[model samples]
Target chain A: MKILVPVKQVPDTATQVKIGADPKGIDTAGITWIVSPYDEYALEEALRIKEKQGQGEVVAVTVGPERAKEALRSCLAMGADRALHLSDPAWENADSLTVARALAAVIKQEAPPLVLFGRQAIDDDMGAMPAQVADLLGWPCASWIMEETISEDGKSVRAGRQVEGALEIFTIPLPCVLSAQKGLNEPRYPTLKGIMGAKKKEIKDVKAADLGLAADGAQLLVVALEALPPRPPGRIIPGEPAEAVKELVRSLREDAKAI
Target chain B: MQIELSEEQQMIQALAREFAEKEVKPVAALLDAEARFPHETVKRMGELGLMGIAVPEAYGGSGADTVAYVLALEEIAKACASHAVIMSVNNSLYCDPVLKYGTDEQRKKFLAPFASGQQIGCFALTEPQAGSDATNQHTLAVRDGDGYVLNGRKVFVTNGREAAVALVFAQTDPAKAHRGISAFLIERGTPGFLVPKVEDKLGIRASDTAEFVFEECRVRAANRLGEEGMGFKIAMGTLDGGRIGIAAQALGIAAGAFDLSVAYAKERKSFGVPIAQHQMVQWMLADMATAIEAARLLIWRAAALKDAGRPFGPEASMAKLFASEMAMKATTDAIQVHGGYGYIKEYQVERYFRDAKITQIYEGTSQIQKLIIARHVLGAR
Candidate 1:
């Protein structure tokens, strides 16, 4: 069986974000980039699935500019067998669906048994890849997948998904898309040997045009972005216990609208 | 000049950093308070190829360079100095010497296991009477046919208790003074070789600093490392690399403290505002950041020189001296930045302050480093 993982690199969660001068995006200066934390779950699940089967290939694919190659390399370091990077100048302004379409094109060529994705990219919080890619391919997909197992026969998938307050189980057929949720699995750190091996193998690059797709012309344009307004100052109720409690409750309900 | 780490180096550093943050830091205080060795994390480190970062792959090591080793060591040190020193001893003190000076046969035996992380190794050089005056001859190895009978006491030996093998230095010819010293690879469980004591320390309390006593111990002449008088040269060269590890550890300790202070200053309020807004606190934070960067550069230069196979003795000494002193000053001010909270055990800056002192004291004290630097600059012994 061949498993493919689609990954994205985003700013580390620890970054102090500042709105860029253009007001449409955050400042990129001094920001450290990392594999999206949720997507890290996707990589972990793919690697784990490969380990359990004991006989399969794990390929990681990504669609982004040159910097996205680092994310693929990181996946390789984390024990992915191969990396396929989709690069194109037109991809610079492509919308979410365009990116998904390009990935779907690669998916068709590889024709892997399973494709794993993070439920959402932390940067965009779209949570749209599995649905978009699966819709493009006309295959069944389950998003927010928390638990999964491939049958011994390797012809079907037993998956558990996150819901309002409980798990929803589904026995989906073979060759499906699954978006990993937080509890899917714990990710492993890239070992030293794996890192050296990651350096040895070359990442295969592909052009969107070669895939017979127009990468330009985004479907949706991002309007002006706004920074969150500064928080109001804290207030201390200046009274003893009895009056302070009443005043605090009154202020919470009437002035702050918190109650 | 900016030092750029290669991708492999960055990954190794990141792995170590993640390990430190997730595994080492959470248990650091408990381990320190209990004075317990971190067996679980150390074992994981070995498995991750951190224990033998600079050792070659052929000998079961990760086969990276000195720069990579220091980068990993600094990250571990940032979370817990104890873990850092344990890694440092195995890499620099035990595995390094055996790899460089041991024959292939000896390498297979001594270097492979430690570098592979299956076993730990230690250096037995600092005896009760041989602290700064390491030339003092107290340990003896008397030739008994093709083997030798050894007797000595080695103190302040890092990783001494848990190490599977020890590289012991002893006097073979009394008249030759320091030249008489011969190094031997002695495995644990050898009859008459014993760990008589383990010290409870001022800092890095999680690591075991032990005293090994040898009485009527026997070893094959084949176990000897290099020529008999070459022991002094081996020990000095080993310390050169060991000093670099210590410098990185010191830098990490200070960097860790500075991070705490910076985060604390932003949230900790005094005089109706965050302490970070105050001029005095800003000065402290600025100085800490600048000193840490400066210390890191020195350490990088020394590590780079070693990687390039150039002479880095004086440079290593300089790095150790400056970084250790800077750690002291940085940790002190870190505690000062936290004010009353820093004075308590619940806060971490106090621990950093305590841990910083030992860096100045061990792996050749700050004074010793200055002397080496001074001697090198003056072209005098």
Candidate 2:
């Protein structure tokens, strides 16, 4: 059995982002890139499945520029058997549908028994790639998956997904797609041995053209980016406790009109 | 003249930083307050391959170079100096010499488990009377049949009570003095071998420093490291590398204290403004930053030299001397920056100050390091 995990490299959420001069992208200076948190869940689930099976391969696939290899290397360090990096200058502005199409092309070639993705990339939060990839592959997909287990014969997968404060369980046949949610599983830090071994592991880079991807066209385009509004200054309520409470209530009810 | 870290080195640094911040930092205060050894996190460190960072992979180590080891050590020290010393002692003091001098069988039996962190190991060279004068070993190992009968006491043995194995130095021929010393691989369960006391230390309180008494303790001849007269040479050579580890630890302590001081300066308001606005505070911060950078360069130079299989003894000593003194000063200034809060345990700068003192004393004292460096400079033979 083979499990494929699609991962993305994004600026760490803790990073202080600055809008680039173009206003459609973020400035890359001094920003540390890490594997998207949700995608870590996907990779962890895939690794767990491979371990449970006792015999299988976990292949990490990423579509981006050269720096994306760092994310792939991280997955490899976390015990992925190998990696596939779709690298090309043309991929710089690819959209969800185009990325899904490129991933579909590679998935067709590899024909892994299971495909996994994060519910959404934290960077864009579009949450559209997994469904689109599933559509392209004509495979059943279970999104926002919190728990998962595979059958003994590896012919089917049972997954629990987060849905409106409830868990919705789904059983999908072999060769299915799953988008992992936050509560799926805790990801392991790569061991030092694993990190060393990862250096020797194979990472096969495929060009965009090799994956039958075009250079110019993308279905969805990003136009503008803006920072969130700064928080308003806090006001201190001063007086006796009873008087302060009265004044605070008066301000909330009358001046601020929050009440 | 390139001074850039390799990708592997950078990866280990990042991993260690994350581990130190997440695992060690959370429990550091509790461990220090209780003076309790962190068995759980130590085990986790072994599982993470930190226990044997530079030992060969075939010998159950991470197979990293010395540069990687120092990088990781510095990060660990940044969060908790207690954890840092335990890791440093294991990697540099115990595993390094064993790998360098142990026979293949010895490597397989002794080095593998300890380096992999499945078992713990300690170096028992510091005796009650033999602190700075290491050559005056009183422990005797007389030849008896296929092994030797050892009798003496060793003090200030780090990881002593907890370790399963020990690398002990003993005199085989009393007349030869330092040249008479021989190294032995002694197991914990060996008869007449006991860890009689665990010291209450001023700093690095979370680690166990023990005294071992060997009363007719028998050790196998095959367990001997190098040769009978080669022990002093082996010990000195090991200390040369060990100094690098200590330097990194000192560097980390200094860096950690500096970081806290800077943060405190920005947040602490005095005279109606943050203390950072004051020129005096700024001068201290600048001095600390400059000293730390200088010490770091020295450490890196020593580590790179070791990695390149060059002579790094004097450089290691220089780094140790400078970095340890810098740590002491930086930690002291950190306390001053925090005022009364730094003097207390809650802010934790006091702990860093305490930990910094030992760096100037151990792995050959700052005085000893100067002597070594002076000897190298004068080309004494």
Candidate 3:
């Protein structure tokens, strides 16, 4: 049995993002890149599946430039059997759809029994890649999966997903796509042995053009970018309770116009 | 020469930093106050392959080099000096000498479990009268059929009460003095072997420092590490490597204090503005930072030399001496930077101050390190 997990490298959520000089993207200077937190859930789930089965290979795949290899190495350190890095200059500024297409091309070659992904990359918050990839592959997909179990024969999977204030469960066939949610499972830290072993593991690189991608493959484009405005200072009503209440109501109704 | 960390070293350092911050930091103060050993976190460290960073995978270790070990130790010490010393004694003091001198069978029995973190081990060398004058041994190991009957006392044994195995040094032939000493692998719970006391320490209170007494305890000849007369040489060589670990621990303590001082200086107000605006405070911070960086460079040099399989004794001694003294000074100034608050337990810089003093005294004192360095220099001349 083989499992394939698609991971992305994004700037750490705690980083203070600065607008790039070109006004097109976040500044890369001083930004530390980490494996998307949601994607960690996806990888963890994949590893758990492999462990439960007693034997199987978990392949971690990614689409990015050279710096992106760090993310792949991290996955390897986390006990991924191997890594497939799709690298090319054409991948720069690629949209979710373009990423899906490249991933679909690789999935066709690998033909893994199952595919996993994070519900969304925190960087873009564009929860579209998993569904788009599933569509391109013509495979069934269950997003925001919180629980999963595979049948004995490995022919089907049952997954429980978190909907708005409700639980939605689905039974999907093998070779389907699944997106991991936050509560899926806790990821393990890479052990010292694993980190050393990762250096010796094989990381096979593929070209974007070979995956049938082009510079014009990106369908989404950002025309402008701006930082959110600073929050307004607070106002304290200094008076007796009744008078303070009256003053607060008046400020809310007239000055701030919040009411 | 280039002084950059390899990617693997950087990765381990990052992992250690994250572990220290997330798991160790929250409980450090509570553990110190209670003097409770962090068994859970130490177990987790074993799972993360930190317990045996430099040992080979075949030997149930992480197979990392010494540089990586020092890097990881520094991060752990930054959070809790107790955890750092516990890790240091296991890696450098116990497993290292066993790996170097023990036979293959001995390695499997004595080194594997400890290196894998499945079990703990300790080194017992200092007796009541044998500290700086390590050559004087009051412990006796008389030859008996197929084994030796040991009778003696050892003081200041780190990880003593909790360890499953202890590498004990006893005089096999007292007539030969220091040359007569031999190292033996003694298991806990052996007849007549007792941990009489667990000391109440000022700093690193979370770690156990015990005293051991053996009365007619018998250890098999097969358990002896190296030849009978090779004990002193093994002990000295082990301390040379152990000093590097202490240097890294001292560096971490200084860095931890320096971090708190910087944050306190920025927010703390004196007269009209933040104390950071004062020239004297700025100079103190500058000095602390400079000393820390210098000590870090020295530690790295020693660690790198060891990894390269070169003679690093003087370098290790130099690093330990400078870094230990630097930590004492830095922690003292850190308290000064914090004023009265630093003197209080809640500020935690006082704990760092207490921890710093031990580094100057253990694994060969600052004075002893100077002597070793001088001997090397004169010998080379």
Candidate 4:
């Protein structure tokens, strides 16, 4: 099986996202970029599925500006067999559908048996790409997959997903899309040796035009991005354990009102 | 600066962290409290090629770079400082010197088994009276025709009680002083050698630092690491690499402490919100994060310089000095952040605090590192 992992480079989760002066995005300067947390899960799951099935190649595919190469390089360092960088300036402000369409066009050329993506981009919280890509490719799809097992002969995979207080399992055929969620096997960091080898591995690039792609099917356009409201300063009410518990319950009921 | 780790280093980092988190952390307190050598973990580390990370493949080692060694050591230290020290002495002190200065035959005989993890190795340099002043070695090695007769006592030797091979340093000629030192490879079964005592320490008890006596121990002349007077250079060189390992270990301890503190700050609510919301708490976390990053950068810089075959003694000393100090501050602050829970062993920050103190003491004291840096800066003899 040739597995494709669609990745996105986002500010590290440790970063405090700052609203850009342009009022449409987070300030990018000095912010460390990491492969999306969920994409890490997706890449790891794909690698595991490949390893378990005896033999297969895991390719990470990402559509972004030049700097997205860092994401691809990191995935390659973590033992991805190869990488495909879909270069396009048009992708910067493009909607989820545009990304899905671009990924679909590029992935079609490689023609892998399976494709994986994060359930959502934490920055945008738009969980639309995986379904859109599946639609474009006319393949079965599974979302929010937390657990997975591949069948014998590498013909199909069974995935377990959490859906609104219920667990849903899907046995996706060999050729399908999977959007990984939390609780997948823990992701592995690229080792020193892996990082060195990645430098030598061939990273192929494909233009959006070459892949017969454009932003025609954009489902959503981000406008007027806003920062999360500043959290209230903490107040420490020192007391005994029982008193502390009682005080906490009272505060939850009276102040936050969620209880 | 381009801060990319090699693929092998990345894998080693992941593997080391996984192995440490899963296997070592669970037993760390038990081993430290019992002061028992982690024989099983040591064997596992050997299986993973951690025992001889810098020893070339020709000597049955993993042939990894210095950065890879530090990365692995950091992970191990994050799990258990004792194991980290054992690993540091093996790869940086004992095996590395043999590979660098030993004759080809010496490398095969002395380095192979240790690198393969078939036998553990220890370095003996610190005498009862000397540590930072290693030149004051009181151990004596007398020329006896075809061999050298050794007699001396070395203290604070990590893995001393259990090691199968020891790179023993001694004053070969008292008249020549520091230049008179010589290194000899003493096999474990050598009749006259004995472990006189094991230290009861505040931390890293599981590693077994011991005092060893060489009472007329005899080794073949061919076992000498270099020329009779070259021991000082060899010892200093070994420490140049060893300091980097220690720095990495310190960084790991600090990082571990910082990580736990952050989690606690986010989850442990105080008055009306999680402690993380308090500006004071946030400032503490921010400082911890910044310190860790700075130390890591310095550590990596030293490793990179060493890998590039540049002069790194001053930088390595700086890294060790800065990182160890950073660890001390970070671990202490971590405890403060945890308040009552931090003082108790039930929370891991206390152990981190205990572990952090050693980084400032061993490999080289932070003060000694300052002297080294001063020497480099002032061109002091």
- Global CA lDDT of candidate 1, please? 0.91
**For each candidate, how many residue pairs have backbone atoms clashing (under 3 Å)?**
0, 0, 0, 19
Q: What lDDT is reached at residue A137 by model 2?
A: 96
DockQ of 3: 0.87
Provide DockQ values for all models, in the order shown.
0.67, 0.75, 0.87, 0.12
> Candidate 4: lDDT of A91?
74
- Computed on alpha carbons, the lDDT of every model, listed in order, comes to 0.91, 0.92, 0.93, 0.87
The residue-by-residue lDDT of candidate 1 on B224-315, one tens digit each, is 99988888889999999999999999999999999999999999998999999999999999999999999999999999999999999999
Model 2: per-residue lDDT, tens digit, A151-208?
8877899989998989998889989999999989988888888888898999999987
**Candidate 1 wrong stretches, greater than 4 Å:** A234-259
- Model 4 residue A170 lDDT? 85
Question: How far off is each candidate at the interface, as Cα RMSD in Å?
Answer: 1.0, 0.8, 0.4, 4.8
- Candidate ranking under lDDT, highest first, comes to 3, 2, 1, 4
Which tens-of-lDDT digit does each residue in B1-381 have in candidate 3?
A: 788999899899989998998998788888899988889998899889888889888888899999999999999999999899989999999989988999999999998888999888899999999998899988999989999999999999988988899999999999999999999999999998999999999898888999999999999999899999789889999999999999999999999999999999999999989999999999999999999999999999999999999999999999999999999999999999999999999999998998899999999999999999999989952
Evaluate residue B49 in candidate 2 and report its C-alpha lDDT on the 0 to 100 scale: 96
How far off is residue B27 in model 2, in Å? 0.6
Q: What is candidate 4's CAPRI-style docking category based on DockQ?
A: incorrect
Off by over 4 Å in 2: A235-259
